[model samples]
Target: MTTNAELAARFEEFADLLEADDVEYKPRAYRRAAENILAHPSPIADQLEAGNEEAVENIDGVGDAISSKIVEYVETGEIEELEELREDLPVDMAALTRVEGVGPKTVGSLYRELEIQDLDDLEAAAEAGEIQAVKGFGPKTEQNILENVEFARTIGQRQLLGEARPLADDVLEYLESVDAITETEVAGSIRRWRETIGDVDALAAADSGADAIEAFLEWESIDDEIESGPEKASVRVGDVRVDLRVVVPEEFGSALQYFTGSKDHNVRLRNYAIERDMKLNEYGAFDVSDVDDPDAGQRVGERVAGETEAEMYEALGLPWIPPELREDRGEIDAAAAGELPDLITQGDIRGDLHTHTEWSDGNNTIEEMVEAAAERGYDYYAIADHAEGPGVVGGMGLSDTEILEQVEAIREVDAAADIEVLAGIEANIDADGEIGLGDEVIDALDVIVASPHSALDQDSAAAADRLVRAIENPAVDVIGHPSGRLLNEREGLAIDASALGAAAAEHDTALEVNSNLRRLDLWGSAVQAALEEGAIIAINTDAHQPATLEYVRWGVHTARRGWAEPADVINAWDLEELRNFLH
Candidate 1:
């Protein structure tokens, strides 16, 4: 069966092939269709199979042409046009594009000039000094490609949390619907809410393991069954691998603790148990100092805790730790000292400061965005559209005149809205650390999110200085996506976090944790450092659409991982408190 992920991949490949062939508008259309397809809540195959082509076409950015292709692929398991395009280019698009500086155009150029068909072919040509012979290819570009290709090869693939979590939720809901499964939960790095997951681990408490395993295998979402046993099963849901383990209800707690681990955390817990003459395992926690064979049975000697995860932790003489704090980064000690922080929660956030509208590249209009924020019960929302400057693509940025016009539009929206809508601009910070917007324009706005959009290759000292200067700007409320890094794609700016954090704290400027999955900037460790240095954090979704407002949870969890309290985040404050900080 074709899943949304599979269809999205094919569409992306189609886009890459079209771009390689120098096809103009269609490539962008294909790419947008791919993104919308991935973000679609339900499986695309189901819609196609139901013969609802109109519903499929209704997907944002998907036109009749793309919808027809999706239906064809669903019915025939292939798209003939994509096949023909592949036959024409015939190079490994995914592998070649993984190289840092190489893009589809470069791939097309290399294929035509040197007949390079794969990474190996490209590497051999580079090694032989033949790549520089191509018209636009220089020796430095070839050398950089050779160096980056190896790193790309070594880095294994991991699904982003944004993608993996939905699949995990589906699995959990499926298991809960079964009569045999009493309790079910997802484990592994997903439970820890890591940015990426290798494979999903699910656990179930059942009266009979065989019954639970059978129900799991029968789940409709399973595309392929990899393996199955009396107590466990592994299946492929779309492109993701899910492993299910069933244990007797009595042992659910110990089993959950064992599976939901950071390896380091479990190791520390085991050592701590040993000091108390107890044994810890997946079956249950046991007092084994007097037992002849501690491993004699699943529940050896006297069982202390196994029914619930809280019980399992209580047996270890510690309070129940939040899953996000299970990283073994002083969390154990903090729990022991009864000093665990009251971490920030989703409900604590009162507003979103950095958002976009159709005035920039966002899909929704200013009124639509404001209405969405009001619906979400936010006290205030800021319309921080792109200001004319670096990294603004396709003339998406607003000029000074346009910014003034937008301000009036924002005011009109705010007048009818239940929530406060602040007129703001996402100004670009130039390489010299000056904001692209004029001082008058900056001061005219209720908020300013100054971000480093270009010159990301600066050295550590320069990057730190650049950010410090932005923080020092009296009108700037937040330094957005401090490094501008995109997960698994770009290693954006390299700044001295301690220096940046101190400067931000001193200047009363908040550092932003842009919650877009691709750019979860001011990630856990950076958030921790900044918070420790008295810097205020703002967990903004950097949401471009209403659907993306849900991404704020990702930032909240990431902040918890960094030990940020509600008070540490500016968005968590009340309207008056937020206003005080902004001023």
Candidate 2:
């Protein structure tokens, strides 16, 4: 009943939990198996149902033990081996490890030494002076655990992109302002434009390591210092930890490429490099002519490093892949064939399709929003604030009458404004997957992006049905943030994306790759699935404010990761074609 990807994800979660418990090589084995399972096209369950359990052995990196476990899981809907492992060290292991300074080994040690089973137990132990009594843990370590426990409880798991982006920018600006810093760029999930962030990673290419490290520690924006070292430094800015790594200029680009990764993407790229007879590392890639020779490529006769990203890619016979397209979702082949998607660039966006003014929770007025769009060289802008419905409460949504009044106001603004103004509404997708706006109201709008804001708890089957029904609505021009996810904060609706994509194609509805960094809802995997289903994506910035309009960069990045080319994006079409699609 489960898909290969789901099986892999479950196994990966178990592996992460096991890793946090310091369970040793078995954790690595599980993680490796998870990786192989994710890429396997055939459903392991289906294969098992068809009585081909040995098919698991065909998966690379899945050895006998893992294959047996998969057979057990597929047969009985459970893995006895995993259950036994959980029983041995049964605790809130995942939660315990989620703290800032806590990892698997630390969690294991604390459990063994202090008998701390959960967050509350660990907190009690930390307060009762039991933790500092452990050999490796000292006064500082105890303080860190206690401080982080409070933070962990207050902040939950990950920070939203809206909160994390500004912090990364602030840190980068501060680092750049310092005299010791030569150059700096944000790397990690933030740079990759992942919808959520666990930590903000920054890599600085500096001449003096000591000076850069010192400058980083003294940054006023840093609320608390976590760790400071020669190559790397970590500090807690509010709830988020900002990590900075200093690299020599020679390997800066390579380091940037390595550090800016979705771990799976990096693994595939690494394998690709190895297959090409090269080796990639934090330092620039090496020829690795002789694997037995540790210093073979760095020897006197060989070139040791790539000074730029292009050279690094060239070493592997790959054209330089963009950071956003580094998800390995098909970009490798696209890059190899020189058919990389010409994704929508920021300059190509002539106007914002959906935005709010003071009429909603927006920070600016409609006129101000338009002026900002004009500043970005936009020829037209649409004011598409929320319409009253299931998700909109506390005066956040406009009533039907108010929506009509706003349309007239938009017409008035259009007459006086230099750029054309269109009236639009972010209509609500009701409980039964129908837009609340009637045909008359829908006809009055230039465009309507119907979105599911509530009832996100619908099961996968029901969610798919709901979305399919909504996509069939003739008034729906775009399905906003198709999944409704807010990164790590919210899982959003569970729908069969491939099915949804096919339905959208049939209905001629554009799926919005919402530019909000927190809600890059159509994830890279979903985007790839959608494109394969021939679904058109509109890379729109559901801009609530002018400053936030720049989030299109994040949307573009997400689309590129999905291997989407300009042709795949409805917004990438010319204005005439776009208008025709809207109508």
Candidate 3:
């Protein structure tokens, strides 16, 4: 089946190919269609299969031309125009675009000028000092290409949580429908809410393993069966691989604990069990010291605990740890001492501080965004549209005059709404640590989310200093996506987070944990460091559409991984308390 993700990738590549050829307008249209298709709730293949061509065409930003291509790909597994474009520009667009400063145009230029085809060819040209000889290219550009090509080469193949979670849910639902399956869960990194997942691991408790495996193999979404047996099966669903394992009811707890792991965490647990003259494995926890052949069989010992995950932990004399805290980053010690912080939950959040509207590259209007927040039961919502400056292109950022004009527009929306609307701007933080907007414009807003949009390759000291200066600004309320990193793509700024956190605490500024799966900046470790320094966290979705507001859960879980409490997050406060903080 042609999945929505696969279709989106094809359209994105098509856009790149067009851009490389210097074709204007159509490339942007294709990219917009691709973004909406990727974010669409239902699979495009399903709609096409159901003969809903009109529905596919009606998708936001998709038109007759793009929808026809989608239908063609769905029916024939190929798009004629895309194939023609590929033939014309037979270069690896994805690989070339991975470099920091390289774009589709750059790839086209390099290929035309030096016949560079892939990363290796590009590297050879850079090493041979030939890229600088191309028109519009210089020595610095060649050096940058050389430095980033290696990082791009090592980029791991992993699926984002936003994409993986839905497929996991589908598999879990299908397995649960089997009469023989008693309990089922998604384990591995998916259970831990890792930003990127290598594969999906689903576990089941069943009386007859054969029955469970049969049900799994018959799933509607399974594209290819990799392997199968009575107890286990592996299948490819779309582009993701899923492994299914079934165990008896007695061993479900142990299996879950073992499989839902960071390798380091499991190793520590196993060593801890050894010191107490016990053994721990996927089968169960057992008293090994009393058995002559503890390893003789899978369950060959005096079993201590295996019925529940809490029992497994109790056998080790520790509290039941949350899966998010299973990263072996002092979580064991914290659990043993009963000092683990009370983590924030979905119900704790009362408002959103970062969002966009049609005024600045967002699809929805300001009124639509405000109403969406009200529907979510939020007490307040801030409209932090992009402010014009560096890295702001395609007329996607607001001028100072335009931003001031939005104040009244926001007020008009707030007048008939249940929630308070806070007019704000996402100001760009220049390399010199100055905000793009003037102080008067900054002072006029209800909230200011200062962010670094350019100069993302600074060294550690420079990055830390740049962020600290932003934190020290009295007009700034939150430092949005502090590191500017994109998971599995660009390695944004490398900063000393501890130093930056202390400065944020000193200046009463909050650091944002950007909730977009692609950019979960101020990630787990950074959030932890900031919390330790008494800095506040604001988990914002950075939402551009109504559906994206649900992403706050991702940020909340990421925060829980860092030991954040409801009190530590500003958005979790009540309206009065939030107002006090803002004031």
In terms of TM-score, which candidate is strongest? 3
| Predicted structure 3, TM vs. truth | 0.96
What lDDT score belongs to each candidate, Candidate 1 first?
Answer: 0.86, 0.76, 0.88
By descending lDDT, how would the candidates be arranged?
3, 1, 2
Give the winner by lDDT: 1 or 2. 1
| lDDT (10s digit) by residue, model 3, range 257-309 | 99999788999998888888888899899988888876688777789898678
Cα lDDT, model 2, residue 506:
92
- Colliding pairs, model 2: 20-104
TM-score of each: 0.94, 0.69, 0.96
Error of 2 at 123 (Å): 16
Q: What is model 3's C-alpha RMSD?
A: 1.8
Residue 228, model 2: Cα distance from true site in angstroms: 2.2
Give each model's clash number: 0, 1, 0
User: In model 2, which runs have C-alpha deviations exceeding 4 angstroms?
Assistant: 1-155, 177-180, 290-301, 358-365, 395-401, 545-547
RMSD of each: 2.2, 19.7, 1.8
Question: Deviation in angstroms for 460 in model 3?
Answer: 1.1
Residue 194's lDDT within candidate 2 is 65
